[model samples]
Target: MRIKRPRIRQKIIFTLERQLVKGAHYQLLLLAALIGLISIVGGILVMPSGEPTSTFGESVWWAFLRLSDPGYLGDDQGNWRRFISTLITVAGYVVFLGSLVAVITTWMNRKIRHLEQGLTPVTANNHILILGWSNRTIHIAAEIFQSVGRIRRFLEKYDAKKLQLIILSEEVSSFQMQELKDHPMIGTRAHEIVLRTGLAIDREHLRRVDSLNASCVIVPSLAYGRKELISPDIETIKCLLSLNAEAQAQNNQDLPYVVAEIQDENKINAARRSYTGPLEVIGSNTIISRLMAQNIRHPGLSAVYNEILSQVDDNNLFSQVFPELTGQPMGRLKRAFTRAVVLGIVKSEGEHFSPQLNLPDDYLLEDDVLLVLLAKNSTDLVWRKDRISTDYAPMPFLGMLPVEELENRINILVLGWNEHVPALIRELCTYEDEKYFIRLVGLRPIAEREKELAFLSENGDRVVVENVVADFIRESEIRKLAAETFDHILMVSSDRMEEEEEADARTMVGYVLLEEVLEKASKRPSVLLELSDPSNESLIRRFQSEVIISPMVLSHLLAGIALQRELNSIYNELFTVGGAEIIFRNLPEYGLSSGKKRFDELESLASAHGETILGVYLDRPDASGNHLLLNPAKSHEIGLSDNDRFVVLTTFY
Candidate 1:
C-alpha cells in the first residue's frame, strides 16, 4: 500500500492556521491589506464630477487619508464621493484600526506577563548559572560573594562592572527571587543576579540563560515533591547531559565547568559518564557522614575544616607559585614565611596537581611546585626577612606523653536514623586501636537495622552495632537507652520530615531530653547535633553541643569548588581517610611549661613529634567563647593550661 502525503493546498492551510494561532500579528496584517485594497478600488470608481479627475496614485492617497480619519468625508464635493469615503472609514474602524489596537495591546500584555513569569531570556556573558532552586541556593550564593579573591579575579578578567549570577528554576516564586536579590550578603556584593523560571533540562531554557557564555554551572540536587520517582542524582545527570549536548551542538570551544550535587553515591558513576567536560559531582550524604564520623573521633575538628573551607575570614588555605624559593628545602620554606604557615607543596603531576604535606626537610622543592600556605589573605604570602629571627633554638625530639587512663571501650548513642547512618558507621570503623559500641535508637524495624549492621560488622573490625526500636521524641524512650553510659551522643536529623523546622524541632526535643538525663550523672557525655537549617545554629548554640549543619557545609563546599576548581583535590585529601588528618592533642602531652611559650617553639616541638602545629585551642574560652585560632603570628605568646589542646596535622587518625 502506498501512503499519500498531504496536498500542497492542505499544507498551505495548515501553515496559515499555525501562524494565526501562534500570534495575532498575522491576522491583523491580512485585515489591513484587505481594507487598503477595498479603499483603493472604491476611491478609483466613485469620483465626484465637480472634483478634479484623479490618477490611480492620487485616488489611493485620498483613500488612505479618508480611512485614517472619518472627517475627510466632509470635504467631499458630492454625495457619491462622501458615500465612498464613509464606506472606507467604516471598514477602517471595523477592521484595520480596531484590529491594530487589539494586536498592539495583546503584544504589550504578553511582554508584561513574560516579565512577571521570568520567561525573558537573559543577555549576559561570563555569568555563573545555577540550575536548581532550594533552601541551600541562598547560602551558596552568599558563599560565592564571600570568596573575595575569586570574585575580584573574575571581574578583572571579564572587565565587567559586576559579576552576574543567573538562576534557572521553575519552582522559585517572584517573592523568593526578590528576597534573594535583597539579601544582605548577596546584595552587598559587586554582582547582579537574574532569575528565569524554566526547567533546567529544557534546551530553550538553557539558551535563554546564555549557557554557552557562562563561566560555570551549578546543578544542585532537586528536593521537590513527596517521593522522588526520579531521584535527584538522575535529574542532575539529565541536566548535565542536556548542557553537554547544547554545548556540542553550538561547537563551543570551551565548555564551562559544571559542579553537580548528587544524593546517591551509586548514581555518581552514571552522572560522570554523561558529561565530557570538567565536572565535579559532590555526594552530600557521603561527605557529611565522613565529616560527622571524623568529628566524633576528634572533637572540635569541624572548626578546623570550617576555617579552611570558608573565605570570609583571613585564615584560609591559599596556593601560590614562588619562583624564588623553587629549589629551597620544604623546612626552609616553612621558616621563611613568619606570618603564614606552610602546609604543603602543590606538585603538578601530568594533568592534575596534588598536595604533598609534611615533606622531609632535605626534600628540595621543584620549580613547578606551588606552595600551599595558611594565611589571613593572599597578600600575606610575601616572605618577610625581618620577621624570621635567629634567636629560636631547636627543640629535642622528646616523645609524646603516655595516654591518660580512661575507659577502654567507647559507647556511642545515635538518636535517629537516615540514609547517612550507614555511611557514618562505615567511616567510624576506619579508625584503629578503638573499640566502638554504637547503639542506634530509632523507629525502624530491628531486622532492617540489623541488616545494615551485619554488613558493617562483616566489612569492619572492632566495631559493635545495636539498634532499639523506639520513638526518640519521647523522653522515656530516650532515657531508656542509658544516656549517661554512652561516651558520646549523636543526634541525626529525620529525612521523613520534609519540613526543616519540624525535623529540627524533633532533634531539639531529643537534645533536651538527653541533657536532662545526663545532668544528674557524674560525667556528662559530649553531644553532636545534626541540623538541616544553618540559621538555627544560633538558637541551638546555648546547649553547648557540637552542631553540624550539613546543608550549610555542603553549600560552602560547592561554592568553594565553583570558585576554584583546583580546590576539589584539596578537600578530597582533607576529608577522606588514609592521608593526613586534622586531630587535637592535649597541650600537656608536649611537656610544655605553664608560662608563656613562643609560637615557633611550639611548632618546633610539634615537628619533633612528627606532626605540624596549626594552632591551639584554649581550655578556657575567650570573650566570644571561640577556642581555635589557626596560623597565629610567630611572635605571639600562648599561655597554656593543663587542659589546653593543640590542633595538629598528623598521619595517624
Candidate 2:
C-alpha cells in the first residue's frame, strides 16, 4: 500500500505538470487556483493575530492584499501577522506574478508567430482576390494600383469605399510579402494588399479570403518555373470549381467577375465549362506568341505594345457606349472628341463582344455599339457635342507615297525553345502571302522539335523550319548560325533550366553571344528577347534590342480586363492577324522632307489614308532622351526629318 501511494503521488505530479504546460490558459487557471488556496489558508492562520481582520471574509481580504502586493507587509502590526504576510507575499511571487508574466509572454509570442504565418482569415467584401503565386503576381498587383482610377469607378457600382487586393498562395513567406510591397509600382499602395497562405483548390482555404464576396478574382497561370502535379490550365479550372462550390455553399447563384489565365489554348474550353459566371480567360501562350510573331514582322513594334499595354502611359484604350452618337459616321468620331481618338467599335454578340476595326470612313455606327477610344484618361472620353456644317472639310496633305513592297522571304534565327515556340511558328504562318525561313537552334534533340512542330510542314511554303541541337550560350555555336544573315533574331528563355532566374541568366548569356557574332557583320538584324523575370530588365537595358517580359505583359492584360471586360476584344483586334495593326513609317515614306509641322496637320493627312498618327519616333534622342513620344498634344509642333518615323495605326500592314 505504501509503495502504491508513492507511485500514485508521482503520477499525480506528472499529470499536473503536463496540464500546466499544455497552454497559457491552463497555466493561468492553475495560477488562479493556487492564489485562491493561499488566500483561504493564510486567512485562517491570520484570524487570531489581527485587529485588521475581524471576520473570515475580512481575514481573507487582509491576506489577499499582502499576497498581491509586497508593500502591504510593512503595515503589519505584530510578529505573527508580519510572518504570515511575508509568507503570502513570497508565495504570490512564484504562483501569481512570475507564472502570469511567463504565460502572457508565451501567449503573445504564439499569436505573433501565427499572424506571421499568414493563416489568419481576411474580412473583406467586394475586394479583388488574386490566387496563386507566380513571377507575374507582383506585377499584376502593380498594374491594378496603376489603374486605380478605373478601379475606383468599378467600385462605385458596389458602393465600396476603398480598393483591396487579397492574394492567397500555397505558401506565404515574409520575404515574398516584402518583395510585393517593395515593388516600385506598388510602393505606397501596399496597404491595400493582403496576403494569405493556402491552396486555391481547397474549399477551406477559399473561405479564408471570402472568395464569394470578392468583386473580381484573378488566377495567374503557374506555367513558369518548376512543373507541378497538374497542368496550369487544369489547376486554374480546379480553382474555379472550388470558387463555384464556395459560392453555392453561400446560396449565391452568381459569382463576381473572374479573370483567369489559361496556359494552353485548347484547355480554355474546359475552363469555360467549369465556371458558369461572368468570366474572362486569357490565353497566355497565344498572346505571347502572337506578340512575338508580330514583333518579328515589324521591328520596334515591341516598344509600341509596351506603351499601349501599360496603364501608367499617357494614352490607353477605353470602350464605352454613347447613345447620343448612334447615327454618326465612324470617321467623324475623331472630330467629336478633342482628347480621345476613336479606334474602333465593339459589337455585342449573343453573350460576348467582338471588336470591329478598320471600318470604311462612311460606316455608320448602330445603336448600343461600344466605341473603343484611345485617351489620356476616362475623363477625356466625353463627347464634345459640336454642330459641324456638312460642307466643312479640312485640306489633306498630298505627300502620301505608294505602299512599300513586302519582302519575298525573311530569314529568322531562333535561339532556344519554349512552350511559345510552336505557337509562334503557327502565328507566323497566319500572315497572308508572307514567307518566313526560320532556323531553330536549341539544346533539345532535332527529332524532338521536329515531332513537336510536325504540323508546320503543311505550311512549308509559307514557313521553312530547320532545327539544330546546339548550345546557344556558347559564342562558337552562335557564330555558326550566321545570325547577321537573318532579318530577325529571337532569343527565347530556355525551359531546360529549373529556376526562372537561372533561365534568364542563360538567356542573357545567349544574347551577349548573338551580339558578339553580329558585331563584324554588315547587316544588323532586329533582336527580340523573351525574359521571365522583370527584375532582369535593368541589367539588359544597355543592349540595343526589343525585350518582351511575357509575364509582365500578361499581367497588364489580366489586370486591365479584370477592370473592364471590353479590353479583351480591343487587345485581340490589335494583336490578332488580319486586323488593324501598328506600323512605323519614315518621313520619306510619307513623301515629306525635313520640316516642322503641327501634329494636327499630320493627323488630318493620315485620316485621308485610313491611318491614325499615334506619335513620332525621333531620329535622335531629344532633351528628354526619349526615342518614342506617343499621344502628344494635337496642336504641338514636331520637327520632322527624313530619318524620323511616324508611328501609325493602320490596316495597311
Candidate 3:
C-alpha cells in the first residue's frame, strides 16, 4: 500500500522554531514600513487645489512638493498647504521611530552573540576535557573519543551511545567542528561549536572547562600573539600556574591530569621547576624542527605523519608498560617494539623535556613512565606474511616490510631559520647512525643572520652548512635542491605574521616551494610544512602536504592547564620521554590468531623474547588500525594477518 505524504508545511516544520523567536524590533520594523507607506501616500493625496488641481490627481501632485517646505504653497497652493504640512509631521514620526529601533536592534544582536559565547558543563565524569580552540584541540578530542569509546566497549564495555566529551572555547565554530560533527562515532546529534574566547592566563575562564574534573588536559604548542607585549608562552605559563593554585584550594581528591605543550626548552625547564602536579609539555620547536628537517630532506615525512596521526579503524594506538624490561636491555626489546614499530618510551625517573634529544637511559625499562604506540591487540604480536591459504589469512594487521627490499638510510634537509633549529639539529644528530645519514644543505661561513642556524648545528659545527643562497620560494631554486637524492624536506616559516598577511604569505610561499620541489623532481619524496596559523591549514593541505605543524593549536591546549603548570610536564612524559609513540607491527597468517587464542600463550612467546604487548591492528593503515582490539577479552577472536601491523608501547624499546 502507498503511504500518504505529509503536508508540505508539516513536513518542513523544524525543532529550531522553539530555539528562535522573532525579536520585538522586527515587529517595530513591520509597523514602520506600514507608517512610511502611509506617509508617502498621504503626502501625494494632500496636493493643493491649484489651476491644475481641478483633477483629483492634479491636486495630489501639487501637494506632494509642498510637504517638505511652505515654498510650494506660495503659487496659489491655497488650503492644500495645510494638508502638506500634516503629511510631513506623520513622516517625521515614522522616520524617528524607525531609526531608534534600528540602533536598538544592533545593540541587542551584539549582546546575544556575547551571551552565546559562554559554556555548558557536561554531566559526564572521567571524560577528557579539551580547552581553548585550535587544530590540535580537534585532534585531541578525536583521540580521546576513540580512546574512551573503546575503553567503554572492551574495558567497561559500556554502550557507545552515551560517550561524553566537553570542549570549552569561544572560538569553536561549526566550520572548525566539521570533523567532529561528521564522525558517526560521537553517537549524538550535531551541534555547531565555538568556544567562548578567553585569555589562557584568565583563571575564571579556565574554570569553564572544569579542568579539575577532566581525565586529561592537552595544552598544545603555541598561540600567535602578534602585536602584543605578552607572548602566548607567558600567557600559558600564568594560566597553568593559576590552575594549580585553584586545584590546591579545592582540595579535590580526584583532580584530572594535565597535558600541555612547551614551545621553548628554557621555559619548559622553568615550568618543571614550578609545578609539581601531573603535567607534560610537548616541545614545539624540537618536534617541529626535527620534522621540518626530515620533510626538507625526504618528502615521505608527510606520509609518515599521516600514518602516525591517522585514527580511522584497526589503526588505533595502544600504550603499555613493559614489566620484563626492568632487568633487560632495551636492545633486546627493540625486536618487540620494532616488530610492531614502537615509537618512543617514557622515562622512568624524571620527566623528559625533548624527545628529539633524549635516548633511553640504562634505566628506560626501570622508569615509571609508560611506553605507547599502535598495536594489533593487547596480546603479544605475531609476524606472518610468508604463507598464504585458500581461507582468510590470519594476523594481517602488520604492514610487514618485504625481506628482499632493503631499508634505506633516512635523508633530512632543513630550510628557513628559527631558534628551534639548533635544538632540532642537536637532537637529530644524536639519532644518526648506521641506519640514517644526515647532511646540512646551506651556506658556509654563515652570515650574522645565519647565527640561529649556527647555534642549531653546534654539534655539526665543524661540518660547515652548505651556503646555498637560493630563495626557497623560487621553483627553480627548489628544483636544484630536489635534484640531489633525499628522502624528505621540511619547510619552516618562522617569519612574523605582524603584517597581518606576512605570516600567511611566507607560509604559502614555503608550502609552494616545497610542493614545487617535489613536483619538478623526477623522483617524488616526502614533504612536511609548518606554519603559525590554523586558519590557513586548508590552503597548505591543498599542496598535498603530508606533515604541517601549527604552534597555534598547541597554544589553545596550553590554556586548559590549572595553577600547577603541569601541561609541559605531561608532554615531556608522553612525547619527549617516550611515554607515547606510534608503531607498526605484523600479524601471522597460517596460524589461528583469534581472541579465542590464549593471550598468555602469545604473551609468553613475545615475553620469552621480551616483547610488551599493548594493542592489535588489522593492517589497515588509513583506517587507523581500528580492527585490532586492545586488551582484548580471553575469548575475543584475533582478526589479524602478516600483511597487517600492530602498534606497541614497551618500556624496553
Candidate 4:
C-alpha cells in the first residue's frame, strides 16, 4: 500500500522546524523572516495622529525602529499607535533580540570548540611540517628560525610566499601554543607558524596539515613515557609510512623531503624502507656515542662542533657550485675566497653527492663540483679571482714528519649510565691501538651493566670496563669519584627520572659536585656533560666544560640535513672512527715555531703532509669571545707560538 503525502501547510511547518534545528545560521534566518512579517503587519496597522503626513514607507520604517529598539515605544501618541507599538516591542524582545543573541552565542561557542579540536585543515603550501613534539619541539623551531641562509633559499626554491612551520601533534594544548608564541621569531611573525592536533600515523590526520605539499617533514623521536614500552622508532616509521601512503597517488617530484630520527641503529634501515622518497634517517644513539668517544679523545672538540653547528655562530659550513673556478686545483683554491675557507669539493653522482674533503693538492675541480666552504655567511663565499695572483709562487713541499704518539693508556671516569655508554665503549674500543680504562658509577646494579656490555668481554686488550653501583645525585659519592686520577670524565643524563628537566637537574648537580671536588685536586680531568634539556645549557656555561645538549644537537643536525641532505654523510664521516677527523696540532709539530707566516702558506705546508689547515686555536680568546678562529683570510699574517695550535682535518688511522 502507498503512503499518503502530507498537506502543504504541514510540510511547511516541518520544513521550518528542520531549518531552525539545522544550525545558528539557519535559526537566525528564520528569526529574521518572522521579524520581517511582524514589522510589515505593524507598519500597515498603525499611524500616529501627531504625524498625519507619514507615508506607507515611512510607517514601515517607524515599525522597524520600534521593533528593533524599546526606546521608540514611548514616542507613540494615539491609543491605536501605542497598542500596535507595544505588541511589536513584546514580539521583538522575545523573538528578535533574544533569538539573535542566542544565535550569536551559539555560533561563537561552535567556533571556539572547533579551534580547540584543531580539526581544521591548514591551507599553507611549501611549509615545514613537524609531525611529533616533545621537549625538543622548541629547539627544532628555534634552529629552523636561526637557519637564515637555508630557510631563505628553501622558500625561493619552492616559490613559497612566506616561510611557514606547521606542527601536527596528538593534542594542541594551550601551554604548547603559548610556548611557541613566546618565541622571539614566532612572536613577531605570528603567521609563520601553524599548530594542529592529530595522530601522525593516520593518513586522514596527515592531510590536515597538508603534509604532502610541505617542503620538508621532520619526525623527531618521542620521549619515553611511564609504562610505555614501544620504541620511538616504531612511531617514526609509522609516520613515514603514512606519509608515503598519502603521497603514493601523487607525482614523485611533488613529495616532500623527510628527515626522521630513529633512536635505534637497527631500526634506521626499517625507517628508510618505509618511506620511498627523499629521506634522511638520523641514528641518535650512534651519533651521541661517537660524539662522546670523540670528546674523551679531544677535550675541547665539543665546543668546536657546537660552534660550527650552531646557527647563531659566526662560522658555518656552506656549499656552492662555483663554475668560474672549474679546472683550478684544490691546493690553489685555498686563496680563492677572501672570507671563506675552502674545506673540500662536493662531487655530484647523478642523484647523490659525495664530499671529498682535504683532497690531494693536484686534484683539480671539475664542472658542476661544489666548493665545501666554512664561512660566516654564503655571501662571504665570494670567488676572489684577484686573490689568486698569476705571479704567486708555490711554496716548496716540506718533508713529512713522523706521527706524534698520544697518551696510550688513559683512565676515563663515567658519572652516569644509559644505553649510550655501551656504544661509547665500543666506539672507544675501535681505536684498538690504544688502551682505555673505563670506570662507570651509576644507580643501576653492576650486574645489569655487565650483562648489557657482555659482548665487549673479549676486547679486554683494548678497553677495561669497571662498574660501581652508586647514586650520582649524592654529593659525597661524586666527591669520592672526582678525587680519583682520571684522564677524562663523562656525565650522562640520568634516565631514571620520569621528566627531562629532572634528569637534567640531576646531571647538572653531579657536574657541580665533580667540579667542586676537582677544584682541590692537583690535576683536573676533562669533564663532558650530557643534558637532556637544551634550556639547562646556560646553567653550566660558567664551568666551561664540554657540554652536549642532546636535543639541541639533534635539532641542529635535523635542520642541517633538511637544508642539505649531503651533510648527513659528511657529519657521519667527521664524527665516526676510521674516517677524517678534526684535530688540533701543536705549532712545533707542524715545523713552525716563531716566524710570521701567511695563512695560505700554512695551508700549503699542511697540504704537503696530507692535511687541511682549518684555522688556529690561540692561547687567549679572539675578538669573537672564543679561543678558536676558523676560516680566516688566506693572506692574513700571524706569528706562531709554543702555545698556538693549528686546527687541521686529517685521516685518523
Query: Evaluated with lDDT, which candidate comes out highest?
Result: 2
The global C-alpha lDDT for each of the candidates, from Candidate 1 onward, is 0.76, 0.83, 0.48, 0.80
Which candidate do you rate higher for TM-score, 1 or 3?
Answer: 1
On a 0 to 100 scale, what is the lDDT of residue 576 in model 3? 39
User: CA shift at 549, candidate 3, in angstroms?
Assistant: 5.8
Residues 204-304 of candidate 3: C-alpha lDDT, one tens digit per residue = 76666566765556555344443357655665577678777778888865545666666666687766654567666656667655554444433333343
TM-score for all models, in order of appearance: 0.82, 0.90, 0.52, 0.86
Best by TM-score: 2
Candidate scoring better on lDDT of 1 and 2? 2
Model 4 residue runs over 4 Å out of place are 1-23, 26-67, 75-91, 159-161, 184-187, 223-227, 249-254, 399-407, 445-454, 458-461, 594-597
lDDT of 1 by residue, 169-253 (tens): 7754668667676766776452366778888888888998898788889888754343647766777888888888998899986
After superposition, the stretches of candidate 1 with alpha carbons farther than 4 Å from their true spots are 1-21, 27-105, 115-126, 153-162, 188-191, 202-213, 223-229, 247-254, 360-363, 387-407, 444-454, 457-461
* Better structure of 3 and 4 per lDDT: 4
Residue-level lDDT for 313 in candidate 2: 50
**Local accuracy of candidate 2 as per-residue lDDT tens digits, 1-653:** 44543578888899999998798889888888888999999999999985778789999988888888888879888898889999999988887788788889999999888887789998888999999988778888888888756877788967898888899988887888788778998876776678899998899999998888899999998755545567777788999998888888888986888999997788889898888788888988899999998888778888777777744556778888889888887666766766766777998886588988756556788999999887878888786666233654744534334445456798888998988998899888887578889999988888888887988868998899988888989988887788888889999988777678998999999898788888888989999999988789888888899889887888889988988887897888888886687778787666578899987677777767767778888878777877777777667789877788898877844
In model 1, what are the clashing residue pairs, if there are any?
314-376
What count of clashes does model 4 give? Answer: 0
Q: Rank the candidates by lDDT, best first.
A: 2, 4, 1, 3
